[model samples]
Target chain A: AQTIHQWPVAEIKAVGSPLSLGCTIKGKSSPNLYWYWQATGGTLQQLFYSITVGQVESVVQLNLSASRPKDDQFILSTEKLLLSHSGFYLCAWSPTGVEQYFGPGTRLTVL
Target chain B: QQQVRQSPQSLTVWEGETAILNCSYEDSTFNYFPWYQQFPGEGPALLISIRSVSDKKEDGRFTIFFNKREKKLSLHITDSQPGDSATYFCAASAGGTNTGKLTFGDGTVLTVKP
Candidate 1:
């Protein structure tokens, strides 16, 4: 079975502060990765997706960026945090880019 | 514009009753549809899915009815249980270069009472 792990289950930061969240998938090699954000009681919005290492595509310009540093790891980061950036961030992996499996998620609170 | 849409932002049903959730999309190229179940804090889980080529798909108590011409689909949950309460999201995706990127609906919150 494959397991996806996300770091810093939760975080609280002030505006203008930098933030970084990480995700790692075990048991899957070179799987496609994606990042998504969901506001409180709101729908999900796809932020970025990476099909291979060092190549990431932005689905929506939320002013955030992502990197696939390794085959099993994907990172989401920002130099400055916006009030609107505070939300539940999810990391997902797809074996065939059709049916995706999501991780536990990271809760970010921008103060 | 939102490519995918779901009706009845919220729903309530009694145990043993059937609960239906509807979804529709505007893009004709979208060939895949998947429904996800999410709790308050956890990530969404892929509950079931259907392809445009098929009119219907079923898995145990869950069924998906697809209409390719109308660009519509629906998820039906039979014998609803209280445990089924959660936010259900309808998602659509197309093949080719944009494959696997899903556009999700706002979602429907379902409550099943015993």
Candidate 2:
């Protein structure tokens, strides 16, 4: 079975602070990776997706960027945090042309 | 504009009853529909899904009814239990793109009383 892990389960940061969240998938090789964000009582928004290592596509511009430095690892980062950036960030992986499997997710609060 | 929409922002039902959730989308290119269940502080999990080619899909107590002409789909939870209480999200995707990226609705919170 495959398992996905996300780091820093939760975080509280002040505005203008830098932030970085990581996700790693085990037992799956060459899988597609995606990043999604959901605000409190809001719909889930797709941020970025990557089909292969070192290449990522932006689905929506939230002033955040994603990198897939390794086959099993995906990283979401930002240089400055805004109040609107506070939300639950989810990392997902999927085989080509199938539904995605989401990670535990990271809760971020920007003050 | 929001491409996907779900009705009854919240729902409550007694155990053993049936719970129905409605969803609709605007994009004709969306050929795949999925319903996800999420507990507090957890990621949404795929509960059931239906392709545009099919009108319905079922998994045990969960069933999805799709109306391709209306661009609408619904999830039916039969014999609802307390464990079924959670926020359910309706999502749509364009399978032809093969991106595996889904567009999600605002979600419906279901509460099943024992």
lDDT of 2 by residue, A28-84 (tens): 999999999999777789899999999899999998999999999999999999999
At residue B38, give the lDDT of candidate 2: 97
Once fitted onto the true fold, the runs of candidate 1 whose alpha carbons sit more than 4 angstroms away are: none
Residue B17 CA displacement from its true place in model 2, Å: 0.6
Error of 2 at B104 (Å): 0.6
For every prediction, compared with the true complex, DockQ reads 0.70, 0.73
In model 2, residue pairs whose N, Cα or C atoms come closer than 3 Å (at least 3 residues apart or on different chains), thus clashing, are none
Q: Candidate 2: TM-score?
A: 0.98
Best by DockQ: 2
Relative to the true structure, candidate 1 reaches a TM of 0.98
User: What C-alpha lDDT do the candidate models reach, one value each?
Assistant: 0.93, 0.93
